[model samples]
Target: MNKEYTVTDDEVGTRLDVFLSNQPDNPSRSSIQKMITDGAVSVNGQTKRANYKLRLSDNIVMTYQPLQEIEVQPENIPLDILYEDKDIIVINKARGMMVHPATGVYTGTLVNALLYHCHGELSGINGKIRPGIVHRLDKDTSGVMVVAKNDFAHNSLAEQIGSKTAIKEYVALVHGNITEEKGIINANIGRHPVDRKKMAVVTSGGKSATTVFHVLERFKNCTYVKCRLLTGRTHQIRVHMAYIGHPLIGDPKYCNSKNKFNIEGQALHSLNLTLNHPRTNQQMTFTAPIPQDMQNLLNYFRQTI
Candidate 1:
């Protein structure tokens, strides 16, 4: 099916891709740019560059289709629902639960559980495989997460996060006691030059990343710290901590230390998140308690040893 739109006087001077991006249920702006380059978009029966400014009364046609929608089967898995409403649902996701199905793995994920729990009423912008997932926690990271029940809520939440109006904080047990009580790590992060599976702080060709960390408790060897992400990058906390030579204890991907604690995966957890409600425009903060495994590790460090 084709979609057509005529630029109105109020929309004049907007870029072609920008105009399309503002339309309902459109893919990302980058994807829209690609479509324009690929000749899937035309203005007045002729292709135009993505940045071409709009003209009033221009008849625009789009021949591109959105990504195919594949509905994932819902499961009987339970969810730790922290908050729920007609617009959104917040979850205290457990460690070891993947947020959504990926290649070769399709079950036992947050989406599978959400499909059942939300009664298949999740937002479709992210497609059915990740319906309602506004953001994600690593499979081993337990914490508070927000989900959208509809496209309107999804756009609002995504904008809040992307604009940094939403704040994310985490707690982690690192290998060594950070000497400074508080400090900031500012660096560029990108894919590892060699490993490709890991992220590293690079001097070039990387996205700017910043993390503010405060020492919470000092143990014999390890330190418990609170980290606030100023800029969200993939594995920002883990990579920044590792770059500073205090990789998180039990972090399989970033830490090369011995598994001194019986904790599973990383000793990192999302502690708090602050954002505005899409419908009410009211600010809200949600907290997820530290998982038992990470807490037990802390207690063990405090006692006897």
Candidate 2:
């Protein structure tokens, strides 16, 4: 049996999942979403996605179900540490290493490595297994990611990122020689109209996304560009790069298959992150070197050009 929650003025306009997270005894937001998916939770007596906005007097009824506990086993994985402290750990995750576990890919992830390295000190965010994850990089996009070690740090880092107080920059090797020294890509990113698996810039009901890019170097058929994300949307950089007619090199999903060079995935790397420490109130900046694969591609380009 689950408890019923009546919405109040303070809870009005709050996302359903967020309201559920405020409850101490209820399962995590993701857990509640699973329950809703399984027809266990009802909003105004009807099922809805976890993101449904609550009104001042809506009825939220939930049937509580025990969630399966996740035992994160530590695997001896090598990590490229850029910086570490009692509150946070920044790592240069190698390409192809998923940030966290998913349906078919459980274990042997960055979370597993962090668990092993940090000795199980991680803060649970929204009740998913990603205890310390503040942001994410693509599976093939290697870069610097900061992981929180405790609740205070987790909350602070997440809030900083959400508020755009944290500065993040990426270096990418995109095809085509962009003549402009700097440019901005502004679009609404949403699920592809026909292909739900991919993202596209559309005029429909989509979130506003912006990316500022600067050309670092020019090649005969490619340009090395640096991107700063003003809004973090799924595949924002890749989608923006493609939308500008200069898809990333070796990007199978967005790039043209008739590419001249041989590479794999987008050559995007999260090179730098800067933010204020949650507990210390001291400004901190971290940088990670470009991964070997991206470096190799750049080296090849410099030689041929």
Clash totals for all models, in order?
0, 0
Candidate 2 residue 37 C-alpha distance from true site, Å? 26
lDDT of 1 at 13: 99
Where is the poorest 10-residue window by lDDT in model 1? 63-72
**In model 1, which runs have C-alpha deviations exceeding 4 angstroms?**
1-70
Put down candidate 2 lDDT per residue, 185-267, tens digits, no spaces. 99999877644457889998889999999999998888999999999999999999999999988786688756455555778
Q: Which residue runs of candidate 2 sit more than 4 Å off their true CA positions?
A: 1-70, 258-262
Clashes of 2: 0
If candidate 2 were superposed on the true structure by all CA atoms, what would the RMSD be? 9.9
